[model samples]
Target: MINAGIIGASGYTGGELMRLLLNHSEVNIVAATSRKLAGEAVTDTHRHLKGFLDLGFQNLTPEEIKSACDVVFVAVPHGTAMDIVPELLDDDVKVIDLSADYRLKTAAFEEAYAMEHRDPRDAVYGLVELHPEVAEQNFIANPGCYPTGATLAAAPLAKAGVISSVIFDSKSGITGAGINPSPVSHYPNMAENVQAYKLTTHRHVAEFVQELNRLDNSLTNISFTPHVVPSIRGILTTAHVFTKEKMDVDGVRKLYEDMYRDKPFVRVLDGSPSLGGVRGSNFCDIGFEVDERNNRIVVVSAIDNLVKGASGQAIQNMNMMCGFDETKGLWSAAAAP
Candidate 1:
């Protein structure tokens, strides 16, 4: 069995990691760390994982975790992974960081995020469908939740040269902000409301542009807008693109279906998929409508912010890194409301 460890194991992503790893047959969860709940039973803190992990949360040093596990998942904040990933690499432990630190290859984007690129040489972007090779080779840089949904929604058309330019409008549940309490997450304020918080300056903009740009260098123009809805989980991405040539709805659908024919996680839907349909699974459900009237295409994609967006994708990377089935631990279906 491959030994696994989770650093910064108290947040939503960490908790989801624990839940998925519990059912993962090939993984032996060696350590789960949390400064606040160190030495406490992991279940005591995350009631959902109470009986799954009998071990207590340990406040472990990088050396300690390196010695105990074959791989370490750095699920900390954007600026923090740079510090922990380097030390883990020193011990030869494959690192899968779920942060913005290593996602973008361009140094300028790193500066825009306000975090210095410490180990710029080691990390790889971990969008499993697009960068399966990265998962096979070295340290993985898991894509942000919004980026995952948005990129998958548009990549097929971009590759086929079906669309000239893409505009992505994504809405995510409040949990996408993290477990921290903020004025934006105030219960009264968030309830019965839908607000667009990060209009133009959201950092994921760099990631969306960088990934699509990599696919087709000529595809330059991309517009992205993200909003925070009152719900607790899931992300829905709606992309609008103008086709280079007039394409029928069935033709566009066939293009997407053929693109994802071999991919297990991305599902193309006939009708609009609800957030709850993909809430607890790694699937990115996509559906589209071709506006023959305006010669445009509108596509919608949905994923659980914490699952496909974070922990589940992290596990998918682990499966690829360790030569296990990509859907091994992620075979469970989405939660139904």
Candidate 2:
């Protein structure tokens, strides 16, 4: 079995990673690190994993991690991961970063994140469906939550080179903010309200643009807007895709079905996808319709932000990197009402 370690095991993404990895048939989680929670039971922070995991958090050094783990998952924050990942990559150990540190080109990352990238090495962007070549690399940079859904929604059209412009309006659960609490995540303000932030300049836009532009270099009118809903998980993206040439609903459906036919995690649904259908699962459910009159197609995509958007996708990359079955530990159905 592959021995794995998780860095920064106290946050939402970290906890989610632990939960998923605990059930992974081909992996054995050896070390989970958290400076603040060192010596404490992992269940203390991740109560949902109490019975499944009996391990405690450790404050292991880079040498300890390199010696004990064959693979390391960097679940720390963006700027923080850049500091830790360089040391972890010194050996032959595989590294899958669940941060934006290595997801973009060096210059684009620096500009979008507004921080200098200290270790700017090439890493496969771990959007498994779009780029399965992650199986060939030792390092992978996981895609952001918003970008995962938004990019999947429009990639077929973009690849067909029929898109004139695409606008992504995404609504995500509050958990996307992280475990930390702030005024933006406060219950009183968020409960009955829908708040839209980073209307035109969310950092994740860089990822969507980068992936789509790779498919069609002439496509430059991509725009994205992000909002926070009161729920605790999932991201639902509604993409308004305007095409250069008119296409009917059957043609659009055929495109999506053909693109996702072999991808295990992406489901091309018969109707619109919802949060409840994909909650707690590693699935990205997509549904769309064509508006013949306007020459536009509205595609909706849904995924559990903490799962498909982060940790679950991280493990998917790990599986591919390790040459194990891609669905080895991720075949469970979504939790629904």
Candidate 3:
């Protein structure tokens, strides 16, 4: 069994990593670190995982983590990861950072995140379906929750080089902001309300552009806007993709089917994908329609923000990097109503 460790194990994503790893037959969770709750039971903070996990939160150093684990997942915030990652990588232990710290080019990262990168290197972008070669690397940089859904919604068309421009309007749950409570996540403000933030300047827009551009270098007109919905999980992205040529419904369906036919987690649905269909699961459900009159393809993709979007995706990366089955720990079905 692969011995795994989680740094920053008190946040939403960290708790989620603990939850998923506990069920992985090939993995043994060795350490879960938290600075503040160092001596507390992990279940105290992650109440949902109380009965499932018997581990306590420890305040372990990078050396301790490297010694105890074959792999380590950095679940800290974006800027924080850079500090811990450099230390973890000094050893033979595999590192998977669930942050934007290593996802972009060094120059692009400094501009979008507005922080100088201390230890920038080319780590594989861990969007498993789009780039499965992660199986060959020991380090992976996990994609953001928004980018994962938005990119998947339009990737096939982008790769076919049929898209001229793309606009992604995404609605995400409050949990996307992390476990920290803010005025936006305040129950009074978030319940029954949909507030749009970072209309044209959200940080995740950079990733959507970067990934799509990698597929079709000439494609550049990509726009993204994000909204906070009242739910606590999942991101539903509606991609308004404009093509150079007029395409029919069957043609578009074939493109998506052919692209995702070999992918395990990306489900091409007959109808629109809903948050409930993918909540609490490591699945991205995609469905689309061809607007022949307008020459636009309306594609909808849904994924649990905390699962496929974050922690579960991190575990997925770990599975690949360790040469285990991609779906080893993630074989469960979506918890839908």
What local lDDT score does residue 33 receive in model 3, on the 0 to 100 scale?
A: 96
Question: For residues 216-248, could you state the per-residue lDDT of candidate 2 as single tens digits?
Answer: 999999999999999999999999999998998
Candidate 3 residue lDDT tens string, 112-170: 99999998889899999899899888889999999999999999999999999999999
Candidate 1, residues 222-261, lDDT tens digits: the string is 8888988989999999999887889997788888989899
Candidate 3 Cα outliers beyond 4 Å, as residue runs: none
- How accurate locally is residue 214 in candidate 1, as Cα lDDT from 0 to 100? 76
| Top-lDDT structure, candidate number | 2
Cα lDDT listed for each candidate? 0.87, 0.93, 0.92
lDDT of 2 at 223: 95
What does the lDDT read for residue 331 in candidate 1? 92
Once fitted onto the true fold, the runs of candidate 1 whose alpha carbons sit more than 4 angstroms away are 90-92
Q: What would the C-alpha RMSD of candidate 2 be, to one decimal place?
A: 0.9
RMSD of each: 1.4, 0.9, 0.9
